[model samples]
Target: MASVTLSGLRKEYGDLTAVDGLDLDVDDGELLCLLGPSGCGKSTTLRMLGGLETPTDGDVHIGDEPVTDQPPYERNTSMVFQSWALFPRKSVIENVAFGLKMDGVSEDERRERAREMLDVVEMGEFVDHDPTDLSGGQKQRVALARSLAIEPDVLLLDEPLSNLDKRLREQMQLELRNIHDAVETTFVHVTHDQNEAFTLADSIAIMHDGDIEQIGAPREVYDDPVSLFIEEFLGDTNLVDATVAEVTETGVIADTAFDTEVDVRTGDAAVAQGDGLSVSFRPEELDVERVEGTDGDGASAVTGEITDVLYRGSTVRFYVDLGGEHLFFEQSVGADTAFSAGDVVRVSWDPDDLLAFAADGARVGRGET
Candidate 1:
């Protein structure tokens, strides 16, 4: 396994830039995911790393070697595509050994290595099966085994499990993580699926408009986003519009869309009075209690009536109408005192749990408190 590095990497198509000047480092044997929406340059970056696309500028390094100019076959990297492009006419074992044969390994050695890789991917029993006869999940395992048979310094995965059913895809995510641990190969996976990245990657690099918005472990990025875009893209949360009413040493007092003033904890953010801001109240961070009436007056709590209750498998989501504005919170289905629609509830949260953003969508304050 080898470390991967990209320095000032860029890619363009005419006037449109697919990848801006980007810099990133992947530790040796680490599985780093390039995650983003479509048109965000994640796939393009992966293509560049695999030598499938030439960068408009900058360098690509695999370990100590500069490989920006190398062809796909010359680079010590193997790519598993989304389509799982297995040879239709070839047997599973033949397909797995094909790369080794191309490298001129003896027939017996290549076959032995192919069988070992098939076993590694739990496909040893299907070695002689036709690729066309295998199920989607089985075909994916064959494709992964074929890539691993090459014993590459780095493996590139381009949304390999996207074609399977949701259940199969989720199952494959765990198996893929286990396979990565076993092989210990440096991996760069590109995907737009948030849960997949969170499940498979050691580190996630979130991309936006051709550049990296943030890069960190799954929980770190989800809990402490650097901007409003990151916060909204990471998960579901209530964003209430407000204007800063007063700046205090601890944080700020802001008039919210719920027709109430709440103290928001902003740690050393350059905020002032009258500035328009959007405060994110994550559903999981809220505390809700069934109340009798809307006459309660608390700075940290708002009285609202439940407008809708959605039963989502093991959890329930409750949407509340705070005057004209709406906010939602979730609870486990097994929790005591389940609420229903039209129930009066009081929603409260700690001031420090709030995350405020400015008009330009930049996060207000240093997130470290």
Candidate 2:
């Protein structure tokens, strides 16, 4: 296992800058994921690390060695691509043995290593089968076996699970993380899937438009997204424009966009009076309950008619129209949620779940999302 370092990494295509002066250090044996939407330079960054694309400016080092100018073959790194690039005519064992064969290993040793790698990926029974005969998931395992057969110092995965079905892709995510833990190789994975990064990475580097927006643990980045872009990109959130009314010892009080006052947790952020704020919270953080007798407990933060109820198998999504402002709320699967469109309901939420961000999208002391 080896640590990878990138400094001032840059890639340009004519007038467009794909990667703009990026600096990142991935620790040894850590599974680091470069996560972002398409056109965010995640794949480009991965290509540069794999030596497939030369950077316009900057350096890449694997451990103590400078490998900026080296070709892919000399970098001692293995890549598993989205297409599972296995030779159609080659058998499973043969494809896995190809890397070892290129490195000048004996035929017997190469086959032995190939079998071991196939077993590691749980594809040992398909050793004699051609790549064309394997299913999508099986082909993926073969590709992983081939990459692991080389005993690479670093393993680079470029959305290797993108081709699989939803269930199979989720299964592979766990298996891939387990494999990384067993081998302890420094793995750098690039994907636009936020859940993939949250599930597999030791640290996530959120990329946006050729730059890193925020990089941290999945929970940390999810809980305290620094800006509106980060808040919306990482996950689904309800964003409301509010004005900072008061900064209290526990949190901050704000006048919500819908003409309601609410207190929100301040995560060490500074807020000033009359500051335009954007409040963000996940759908799960807010709940809808039956509007029983008395209007006590400040239960009615906002009253709205149910505009829609989307049953999503494991959970149901309720869209409420609070006057002109609309927001969605989610709840776990239940047959007792006798809610439908046009039902009057009261929505309530814990103030601690709210995050505040400035109008310009910058984080104020504990405000802004």
User: How does candidate 2 score on lDDT?
Assistant: 0.87
Please write out the lDDT profile of model 1 over residues 1-369, one tens digit for every residue. Answer: 999999999999999999999999999999999999889999899999999999999999999999999999999899999999999989999999999999999999999999999999889999899999999999999999999999999999999988999999999999999999999999999998999999999999999999999999998888788889888888889999999999988888999988899988886688889999999999999999988887664778899999999999989999999989999999999899899898999999988889999999888885644
Per-candidate TM equals: 0.98, 0.93
Of the candidates shown, which would achieve the greatest lDDT relative to the real structure?
1
RMSD of 1: 1.1
What are the runs in model 1 whose C-alpha is more than 4 Å off? Answer: none
True lDDT of residue 264, candidate 1: 89
lDDT of 1: 0.93
TM-score of 2: 0.93
| Model 1, TM vs. native | 0.98
